[model samples]
Target: MTFWFHMNGVGIGSLKVYTNDQSGSRKLAWQRVGRQGPDWNQGHVRIDTDVQQVIFMATTRFHYGSDLAIDDIVMDPNPLVLTTVSQTYPSTASQTYPSTSPPRRYLTCDFEINLCGWEQDGELQWELKRGASPDRTSGIVDDHTLLGGRQYAFFNGHKAVNSSYVARLDSGQVFFQPGVNISFWYHMNGAGIGSLKLLQRTPYGNVLSLWSRTGRQSPEWLKAEVNLPPGLYNLTFEVSAQHHFSSDIGLDDIVLSEETIS
Candidate 1:
């Protein structure tokens, strides 16, 4: 049990003290916290132990791999020692992020990729299929290439499609609006990287994304959103093939909503 006065960060200023103790050295005694570690070596305290010593120990979690260095220890006397100088410093939490913001949205574009025919492409193409849906109900044609059908990455009268672009929906969807929330669910097998968006065609490039990270990935639901500006937008589930010849991705059920964001 000892006392110490921290001398770090106090700019050069006169410290006034009026002590009645006759023996100054016997007034108080202290053992430094961490005499090792980078900060401690730089005249800083890493830990103030329960029972301190010149050779103090510290437990830490490192984010990087590195060899422990010996010269990281430092020792110096308190420049502001007095009759009794102690400090009850910070312990755990430093700061916290705000928790009241809107939550993120994750949309999953489940493939009617089966709409094509075989399990060949894993339904990963943006192209349309024969007897697809709605439209002429005739030949297989990409809805994005059709008139007003561009709303779909692929769509028709039978089955609807959500695109990587602005579009509409049949049932569950973010329902593009100026003040709506959007998101997507995703499971990619190749590259983990691709741009997902809730984009406006007016500005033509307005966007949103669930993940920007790249690597191989498993299929899963991932959401993203955008606050539109008086035009149409869709919670588009866009993905790029991982050029590694590892095949394509498989997606599950996709859902978009106008629900409150987190």
Candidate 2:
């Protein structure tokens, strides 16, 4: 099993992992008993015992208003394999969107085709801007982003106080196979008051969130990946801002692929 962990305002705390096997007894599998800073950390363990259950616990000796968050927990029975199916990016005006229907193949945008057939909300605001500028030259959407020739769709809360935007693709367009995964690179390192989410339209017409992130994460591009089951779904990219004009977000290098357990 593997997982990501984050902590905030923590002091004199201990993180421990416990496990129980068919013997019906508990034992400590792993632990981190000490002080820690607020940051994103990851952990993994190889359970040699026939573990019946696993437990994670955090104990604080003093009351310091601490917080802990966990995400991206994967417990696959077998080591899963991944194969790339498509990498979608439209660079020219004539380049068209890839068919959304079976073998779903395409990306959201590189900001070359002017949003690349993506529909956006007017209030929240999204625009294609040069990836590199005096104020925003450090963290770009992806490694392929050029200084002046390439651009990315960004939501910089320039004139808005509290903002929200929804960018979506209609349904019945892409055919996603079973065990396929979607991924993208995002830049969310501004005022630490922005959020980004990936959602999909269910068959019954309900939007379900697959993955999400909020606040500043380091000072560079980050990657978000979600494994999806076989289905025809409409994907949506949602962005929101809180407070001032410093909230900024960027997106690029969207990819969908199949996972084969090898």
Candidate 3:
């Protein structure tokens, strides 16, 4: 049987799949396959292993120093686990709560109109981001945006690095893995992309996704169903992103859950 480990979450999106053999002690181990997303994904090490369990981990780090609107993490290890039932955002007065997880946001031009980033309210404020422009909102309702930017986010020989520039998301402990569906209200522009995905691969070799981007560009927020891939995952509303800045993409009301096929 194909056991899928699924998980999904907002902010520093991550999905930790612990495959402990039936021994209840034997941990799961996965070899390197590939990568996705525009984050600084790290490599995985046999962090620890013994007659008890073997543990291998991959880390994804966002570059574009801006908070993104991530909703879930899905991985299909055995059954599936996606969609965050409920969460509590502590301190409404703070932008980042409990600065534990390093910020997963890295930009290119630092913003000014030349470059843009993500946000929590789906707003883009580079300057307010630290070393760019001011905290500004998208002047346009990019339900169908056409962003035009270079491809800085990609999977490397084993490391997915947006070395120079990449998208961003809030900093916290949010993960996705071993699931079947991830619903995100995404918008796209007319531009195109090499690939736009909900999953961002890293060197450690892991699939942190719940319906990701392998292709690029779409004019509307349509649902995407991924069957043949690292695993099975689907989308409710059709959504697309050419993985380009000019392709203007925005995702809102994202829900990571199983979309009934009835």
Question: Model 1 — which ten-residue stretch has the worst lDDT?
Answer: 114-123
> Model 3 clash tally?
70
Q: What's the true lDDT of residue 181 in model 2?
A: 71
Local lDDT at 4 for model 3: 27
- Top candidate by lDDT: 2
Which candidate, 2 or 3, has the higher TM-score?
2
The order of the candidates by lDDT, greatest first, is 2, 3, 1
Residue-wise C-alpha lDDT for candidate 2, range 1-262, written one tens digit per residue? 5566655454546666678899988876545433334556555443433799989888776677556666787674532122233554676444333334322322434555444334443344466666452235333444344445676666665545545543333222233556667667787766634678777865456788888888777567677778875565556687776645556677766766554333
RMSD of 1: 26.5
User: Which regions of candidate 1 are displaced past 4 Å?
Assistant: 1-124, 127-175, 191-199, 203-213, 219-230
Q: How does model 3 fare in lDDT?
A: 0.29
Q: What is the C-alpha lDDT profile of model 3 across 9-73, one tens digit per residue? A: 22233333344654576443322222213443322222222234434354444533323222233
> Which candidate would rank higher by TM-score, 1 or 2?
2
C-alpha TM-score for every candidate? 0.29, 0.51, 0.29
Report model 1's TM-score to 2 decimal places: 0.29
Per-residue lDDT of candidate 1, residues 1-262 (tens digit): 1112222221212111122233332211112221112221112221222323333222223323322222334343321111112344489555432222111121223333321111111123343232222222122232322333322233111121222221222111222333344344332333322322232322244454433434444433233343333333323334443332332332333433444455
Global fold similarity of model 3 (TM-score): 0.29
